[model samples]
Target: MTDLTTAFERVELPLETPFTISRGTQHTAANVVVRIEDGEHVGVGAAAPSRHYGETAATVEAVLPELLDVVEEAGDPLALDRIDARIDGRIGDNPAAKAAVRIACCDLAAKRLDVPLYRLFGLDGERTVTSSFTVGIDDPERMGEKTRTAVDAGYTVLKTKLGTDDDEARLAAVREAAPDARIRVDANEAWTPREAVDNCEWLASYDVEFCEQPVPAEDPDGLRYVYERSAVPIAADESCVTLADLPRIADACDVANVKLMKCGGPRQAVEMFHAARAHGLETMLGCMIETNAAIAAAAHLAPLLDYADLDGSLLLDSDPYEGVPMPTGLVDCSALDRPGTGARRA
Candidate 1:
C-alpha cells in the first residue's frame, strides 16, 4: 500500500456574472480543493460547499484535517466502499467534504492503477452528455442575450434559471434568442405547487425539456402535486440530495438531478444514478457553481447520465485549476485521458 499524504486548499472562483437562484445570488464560488499524493503520482479533487446543505469552504477546511487523519490511519483508498463507509459513519452529513476526500483518494488509486478515472468505475469512455450552460436569473433581454451568446459558443442545450414573476418573459426572450437550442428550466424551489403548474403549462409553449425543483425542497408532496397537474416534466434537484432521499423523491418527479457534492463523490454518484433508475426516475448529473477540479471528477461518470449541467467551470471568470476540455459544449471523456480525474493547478 502506498503511504498517502493529503492536503487541502480553499479557493475562491469568481463567476463571470452573478448567479441567482430562488434562495440568493452568488458572485464567487467558495470551494475547497484536496490533494493526495504518494511520492510519484498526484491526485487532485475539489468540493463545492453549498449553503443549502449548510456547508461552507470554512466548514470543509475545518472538518478535513480531522477526517483525513482517520483515513490516513485506518482507511484503504483502493477499497472505495470502505472509504465511503469511514467518512459516512464518522463524518455525518458533510457530503461536500467527504466528496473531496473520496475524489482525491479515487484519483490517486486510478493513477496508481494506470487507468483513466472512468475506467476505474467500469464506465464507457465513449458515452457522455453535452453540458448545459446555466443562464442565471435576469431580465428578459439580458437572459436572452446570454442564451444567444451560449448558443453561439457551441452550446446546443441551455438551462435557464426561472423563479420570479417575469419567468414567462424570460423564457420567451430565450426562446426568441436561441430558437433551436434544447432548453431546460430550474426554478430552485421558488414556487407554490399551483404556481409551478401554471408556470409549467405556460413553459410548455417554450418547449422546455424539464423543470427542476419547482417547489421548496421541504415539500415533495408539492412536487407531486405539480407533477400531477403539469405537462412539463418535473426534475428534483434540491428535493433529491442523496440516496436516502431518492425513494421519496423518485416518486415525486420525472427526474433526479444528482450532484456529486450531495451524493459524496463519483462512486456514490454512480450508486445514485442506478438507484434513481431502479426507482424508474431519470437522472441528470448536476453541479454547484464549481471549478474545473470538481467538474472533471464528476465528468468521469458521464456515461451514466441522462443529462448534465456541468457548465459550472464554464461560468468561472478564471479558474485556478483546469481539468478536461469541452470542445463542443459537451464533456468529452477522451479529453480527460491524461491521468486520474484530469484536474491540475492552472
Candidate 2:
C-alpha cells in the first residue's frame, strides 16, 4: 500500500476592488489549498471559507489535519462514494474541509486514470456555458465603471451586488454601462419579503435576469412570500447549503446556487444537481472567492447547469495558480483535458 498524506496552505488573494454585500466588505480572500500525495500521484483542491456558513481559514486549517488518516485508510481515489462516506463518518459539519479532501481525491484519481475529471462522470466539456462576472457593491459611478470594463473585456453576463439604499442607483449605473449584457443581482439576503418583491418589480423594468437571496437565508416564509410576488425570478444562494436544505427551499426559490465549498465537493455537488432537478428547481454552479483549483473542478461540471458564477479567480489581482481556461465570462474547458482537475501551482 502506498503511504498517503495530506497537506494545506493558506493564501490571501487580493481582490482588484473591494467586495461588499449585506454582510460586510472584503478586500482580500483568505483561501486554503489542500494537497493529497501517495508518493506516486498527487491531487489538489482549494476553497475560500465564508463566515456566512460558519467556517473560516483557521477552522479549515484546523480540521484538515484529521483527513490524512481517513484518506490513507480509504485507499482508492476513484472510490468516490466510499471516500465521501469515510470522511463524513470521521468528520462532522466541516463542509469546506471535506470539500478540499474530496476534490484532491478526485484529482488524484483522474490523474491516475490519465483522464479529465469530467470523464469519470461521463460528462462533456465541449458544451460550455457563459459565466457571470460579479461587480461588487460600491458607489454607483464606480460600479458603472467596473461594469463597463467587464463588458469591454467580453463578458456577456454580469452579476451585480445589491443590498443597500444605493441599489436603485447602482442598478441604473450598471444598466447604463451595459445595456445589452445579461444582468443578474445578488442582494446577499438583506431584504424583507415586501422589500424584495417591491425591489424585484422595480428590477423587472431593467430586464434583470434574476434576484439571488433577496431576503435573509433563515426566513423561508419570507423567501416564499417574495417568490410568490416578485416579478423577477429568485435564485437562492445562502438559502441552499446542502442536499437536505434543497427540498426545504425548493418552493421558496426558482434556482439553487451550489458551491463545492458549501456542499462537500464534486461528489456532493452532483447530488445537489440531481436533487435540484428532482425538485424542478433550476441549478447554478457558483463558487466562493477561490483560485483555479475549485474553479477548475467546478468548470468540468459547467455544461450540466442552468447558470454559472465561477469568476472567483478572474476577480483576483494576481492568481498564484493555473488550471482551467477562463477568457472573461467564457469557460474554454479544453484546458481541462489534462489529468485530474488541472490546477497547478504557478
Candidate 3:
C-alpha cells in the first residue's frame, strides 16, 4: 500500500498575456498547487478563484491551510470522497479553491494507481476537446482586431463578451472579422428579458451559435421569456450552479454551463451534467480564469458535453501545468487517451 501525504504549494505564474473583461482584470494567476505524494508516485491538482465568482487570491490562500488537515485526515483510497462529504458547505470557500484540492487529490491517487485521471473516473482521456477563446468587451474596432487575431491563431470557435453598450456593433464586427468561425456570446447576466430577446435576434442574423445568461440568474421568468423569444439557443451560466437549479431552468435554457468551482468539484459537476441531461438540457463545461490544473480536471468531462467553453487557460499568458493542450475552437476530443488527465509537471 502507498503511504500518501498531502501538501500545498503556492505558485504565481505571469500570463503570457493579459485578458480583460467588464467585471475586472487578470494579469497573472496566483494558484495553489496541491500535491498528493504516496511513496513512489505523486498526483497533482490546482485551484484558483475569479473576482467575478466572488473569489480572490487572498481567499484561496486563506482556505488552503484548512484543506491541509482535511487531506491528511483522509489519507486512504476513499480519502477524497470522505473529505468532500465532510467539507460540504462547511468551508465557505470559493468552489474553485475547493475544486483544486479535490483535483490534486484525485490526480495523485490516479498516478499512484498508474491510471489517468479520466480512466479513474471511468473515462477515456484520449479524446480531442476544442475550447473557445473568449473575446472580452472592447470597442468594436478592438473586438474585431481581437477576433481576427484569434481566428488567425487557429481558434475555430469564438465567444464574445456582450451585455454592455453597442452590443449590436460588437457582434457585427466580430462576425465580419471571423465569418467562418463558430461564434457565441455571453452577457454574464447583463441583459433584460426583452433586451435579451432583441439582442438574440440581432445576433442570430450574424450566425451566432448561442447566448449565455442573457439575464441575471435569479430571473427564471426572464430566462423563460428570452428563451421563448430568442432566435438562437439559450445557455444557462450563472443560473445553473447545482443540481437543484437544473430542473427550474429546463424550460428556459437549452444548455447548462458546468464549472468545477461552481459545482464544487468534478464529481459534483458530473452529477450536474447527468441531471441537466435528464432535464433535456445540453451540457457545457466552462472555466473561470483558472490554470491548467483546473482546466485539466474539467477537460476530462469534455467528451460528454454538447458544447464547451474551457478557454480560461488560453486567456492566461502562461499555464503552469502541462497536460493536453486545449484545441482551438469546438474541440473534437478523439485524441485524449492518456492516464490521469494526461497532466505532467510543467
Candidate 4:
C-alpha cells in the first residue's frame, strides 16, 4: 500500500463565445477538477460533465468524494485497474466523475514512473493526428467569421456544428471562410435518417471529411439507414459510449467518436480505440468544453486516433491549467517536455 491524498473542486469556466450545439447554448462550462498527491507528485484531472450524458457539475461534485475515497483507500495510484474496478463497483454511472479519478491516477502513475503519459502507454510521439477546431452553432455570418478566425489562427482542420434549420447556408458560409481547411460536421442527433442521407450528399459536395451522429442514439436502425446511404462517412458519437457499444455500432457507422467523460478515462479510452479498430471502425476522440487538466490526458491518446475534436480547452476564455500543446490544431506530443500528462497550473 502507498500513501495517497485526494481532493476536488468545481470551477465555472466562461466560454470564449457562447457555445451552441443542436440541443442548446452554453455560456459557461462547469468543470470539477480532481487532484491526487503522493507526497512529492500531484496529479491533476478535470471533469467537463455533460447533461446530454446525464451529468452536470453538481453530479460530478456529489460523487467525487466517494470516488476519491476509493482512490485513497486503494492507496496506490499505479494500481489503476484495481482502483477503476472499485470505482465502477461503487458507482453505477457518473462516467465523468470516474474519468476524473482515472485521469488523476494515470497522471500519478506516469509521473511516479518518471515518464510522459504517452511514453507510459508506449505511443510514439512522432505518430500523431491534428485536432479539429470546432465552430459551434451560430448565425451563418458569425459561423463564417469563426471559421475565418480559426483559419487565421493556423488551424488546418475544422468541425462545424449543424442541426440548424439553415444548415446549408451555415455550411456554405464556413466553406467560403475556410475553403482549403479539412472540414467535418456534427448534427448531434438532430436529423431523421432521410434528412441525414440528404445532408450527407451536400456535406460531401462541400468536401466535409465526415458527418457525426446525424440521428438520435436510441435509433440504431435509423443510424444504419443513414450510414448505408450517406454519401459522406458517418461517425457515431452519442451511439458509441462504452466498449460494449463497438459491436452494436460497427456496421452502422464508419467512425467511432469516443470521449473520456463518456468512456471513463484514458485506460478505458485505449480499450475502446482498439476495440473500435477490431470492429473495422475509424477511431476519433471528442470532448466537451473542458480545461487543459482534462483535455491534456486525452491528447496523449492522439497516436491512436484517426480524427480528433479536442478543441475543448481552446474554447475556454481562460484556463488555470495547461496541458499538451496543440499547435495549429496538431496534437503535438513532441512538445510535451514534462512528466505525467503535462497538465500543470498555469
Best prediction by TM-score: 4
TM values, all candidates:
0.97, 0.97, 0.92, 0.99
Which is better, 1 or 4, measured by TM-score? 4
Candidate achieving higher TM-score, 2 or 3:
2
Per-residue lDDT tens digits for candidate 1, residues 113-142, read: 888899888889989789888889888989
Instruction: Assess each prediction's global lDDT (C-alpha) against the native.
Output: 0.86, 0.88, 0.78, 0.94
Model 1 regions lying over 4 Å from their true place: none
lDDT order of candidates, top first: 4, 2, 1, 3
Q: Write the per-residue lDDT of candidate 4 for residues 71-116, one digit (tens) a residue.
A: 9999998888899899999998899999998999999999999999
Steric clash pairs (candidate 4): none
Q: Give per-residue CA lDDT, model 2, range 1-346, as digits (tens).
A: 4577778899989987788877899889998998888778889988688888889999989888887578887767777787788788888998888888888889998888898888876778787888999999889999999999999999999999999986899999999999999999999988888889989988999999999999888899999999988899999998899999998998988999999999989979998999999999999999988888777888888767999999988888878888788787777666655778888877
What is the alpha-carbon lDDT of model 1 when measured against the actual structure?
Answer: 0.86
lDDT of model 2 at position 297? 87
Off by over 4 Å in 3: 16-18, 89-93, 124-128, 329-338
**Model 4, which residues run further than 4 Å from truth?**
none
Clashing pairs for model 1 are none
Q: Which candidate, 2 or 4, has the higher TM-score? A: 4
Off by over 4 Å in 2: none
